[model samples]
Target chain A: MTDEQRLYSIWVYLQAEPLFWLTLTIGAYLVGDFCYRRSNLFPLFNPVALSIIIVSGVLLIFDIQYERYFEGAKFIHFLLGPATVSLAIPIYQKWALIKSNAMPIISAVLLGSVFAILITYLLALAFSLEREIVLSLLPRSVTAPIAMGISELIGGIPSLTAIITIITGIIGAAFGTFTLDLLRVKKMSARGFGIGLASHGIGTARAMSRDKTAGVFAAVAMGLSGVVTALIVPLIIFLLKI
Target chain B: MLESIFLIFLFQLVGEMIQKFFELTIPGPVIGLVLLLVALLLFGKYSTSVKTRLEKGLTTTAEYLLGHLPLLFVPIGVGVVMHISFLENRLLAVLFVIFSATVLSIGFTAFVMEKLQNLGNQNDG
Candidate 1:
């Protein structure tokens, strides 16, 4: 074979390997991170958003199927579980703060979760969206795994729920702090908890980058809101009969 | 590092098992988190040294993992490709709902929490 054909064969071989996609995922994220830092950590220039755009652009250009890319990238995705469990460390470390503010924290999360669901539900209805779409959107505020489970139980499309959950997270991470600032919510714990309650892990991650106290409270809020939403969504479904 | 990772995964495994057996709505990792927290609390009561060691290992591991937490979600975010057509039609409505709800909820929660905290402090003082 000619030199060009030989190179093409190597390219085709690498495309089928999981390592290739894994590298692309990490590499794209690093580039996105660099840009985010360069942009002075601007929320709109979010690393996850940038990484998604880069990876998606490459996949589109190469005509690679998302499933094929996912095959390799699932390794990273799998880490989300352990990472979530590891949040216990921070929660434990901040137990005293959490214990003292338990009442406020609990009330905020409970109310925030209900508000998120109610507003999303009403808006989806106002838009006259389909029932399954509405159901999928209901869990959009929770973490992806829990949201996906809730979606399945509530007769929504699980995959769509995952996508919606991610989008909601991105929106929250991008705008959460700014919104808090607008409302004059200056306390780190309150800001973190609010973000986590409305946006889950992604918001917590953003809160982590901003402040340690914020990070811990965000972790606490993320876990609490996950449980609260899980309980409340079903009750709402039963009450509304939707 | 390795031991911490193993412990984290072990908790997640047991959590998954429990979730499956009980048909619980909560995710396995979350259950694992609760279990790990309780374990730490209980272990701390018995031996401070052991609890500290465990906490050190876990803190290192958790920091490393969570430091790059945003990276983990990239793969799924890329899955947006599969729904381009579906999103294209409903993009405006979806964005509107998500944007408004997220902002309003965050504002409402933070505002309420801050207000409540101030109230508590005033009462304590």
Candidate 2:
């Protein structure tokens, strides 16, 4: 065989390996991270968004199926489970603060989650979007992995839910502080908890950069809201009978 | 680090089993999180030093994972390309819904939280 044919054979062999795609996934994210940093960590320059665009473009160009790409990338995806379990560490660490602020945190999360779900549902309905689309949007305020699971359980497209969740997070990260400032909500705890309740991890990251107190509250809010949304969403769906 | 990861996975495995047995809607990882939180709370009440050590190990691993948490979602995000058709005509509507809901929800929560906190302070005073 000619050198060109030999190179083609090697390419075909590498494509079948999980390591190749896993490396590509990480490499693509690094590039996205570099750009994100270069832009001063702007919320709009979201690393996940950039990485998705790059990876998707590559997959499209190569005609590689998403399932094939996922086979390798699942290694990274699997960490989401353990990472979630680790959330308990921070919650445990901040147990005292949580206990003291229990009333406000609990009330705010419950109100915020219900408002988010209800508003999204009403708007989607008014726009006359598809039913499944509306269901996917219901959990858009939650973290991506949990939101995606909720979407799947509720008969919506999981991938679509992931995108919607990310978009919602970006919006929260971008405009959360600004909105809070406009309302004259100066307390760092309030600001952080509000953003976290509405936006999840991305918003928490943004809150962290602003203040340590805000970061802790944001993290706790994100964790609490995730659980609350999961429980209440099904209940709401059943009650509304939609 | 390995031990921390093993413990996390063990919790998740048990969480998964619980979910399966109860036929609940809650996901395994989330259930794992609550279980771990309870375990830590209980353990902390009994032993501070050992709890601190365990927490330190878990913190290092958790932070490492969460620091790059955004990266973990890339694969699923890329899958959006597959569902591009679903989003094509409704992109504007989706964007509007997400934007408005997020902004309003954030504002409402912050306002209420701030008010409640102030009320608590007044009572204390």
Candidate 3:
């Protein structure tokens, strides 16, 4: 048989199985991890970002619809819940430091959430973007689970919010460290907190790659921002009547 | 490993129960975290041997999971593929706004945290 026929047969066999995307997801992540390690763990060599690019590129190349790919991908998606729960470990490990800095952490996260909303609102209005887009944009700094819920409450598209949130995370993770260094922000917790506050899960993941103290603080900051953003967004929106 | 994974899921289950009961907006995992923290605290304060083992088990499992935390987010990142059409129109504006807001928020968070922490230090001094 010709190469064309061989390619078609291989695609047909693999595409028929629901496990394909799951395999692809894990495989992509492994490849990404390998590249990241080989690259000396470059900040931009984020496994999530790389795997998404690789898997999505494959789906696009194969002409497979996202819904079909999602069949197997959902397994990894479901793990997000447990992984989120696992964050309690770092928080638990650094409980003493967090406890000591409780007041500063709470205050900084509160202000950070507001700052995120405030800037997002300003920029969204400046661009005269759609109200739906603006609403979705508001929760971009928060985690997926909370942002998705809040998106529905505030008349935004939850899926769109998820997209924006992830991109926000990816971008923040890529540039946040450099930005912090540029600003000469020498405080370890502050650096971690900034990343977490702005980018959520993706940023926290990046912080974890750097140092333990940074990772612990980023975890707390990400966790705190989730709560503060969930609670305060509505109150601020109500008070400002925005 | 099995024991630790069990503890993680156990807290998550309790978290889900509390979430449904309260109709809370908070993620179940975050609530689970609080429960786990409380348990850790009670155990750390009152018991030694049992606490050590449980803590050891849970921390190991949690560390392992969190260590590769980025892997868990890949599916969600890939889900972005589903929304390209909807976002295609305002893509530039959306990107610009998110980029600016992210930078500004990080800067502001770090600045405010530094000042507040220094204030706390000054008071202690």
Top-scoring candidate (TM-score): 1
Candidate 2 lands at a TM-score of 0.85
lDDT tens string, model 3, B1-125?
78878888888899999999999878888788888877776666776686678778887887777777778888878878656777877999899999899988988898788788788872211
- List model 1 lDDT by residue over B1-125, tens digit each: 77889999999999999999998878899899999999988786676676677678899999988889889888888997556566668888888988898888888888888888887762211
Q: Rank the candidates by TM-score, best first.
A: 1, 3, 2
Any residue pairs clashing in model 2, and if so which? Answer: none
Q: How many backbone clashes does candidate 3 have?
A: 0
lDDT of all predictions: 0.87, 0.83, 0.83
RMSD of each: 2.2, 3.5, 2.6
Better of 1 and 2 by lDDT: 1
Least lDDT summed over 10 consecutive residues: which range in candidate 1 chain A? A205-214
Cand. 3: chain B TM-score: 0.89
Worst 10 residues of 3 chain A by lDDT: A40-49
- Candidate 1 lDDT over residue span A171-203, tens digit each: 888889889878898888888888988899888
Which docking category, incorrect, acceptable, medium or high, applies to candidate 1?
medium
lDDT of 2 by residue, A185-222 (tens): 98888888899999987787667655656767887888
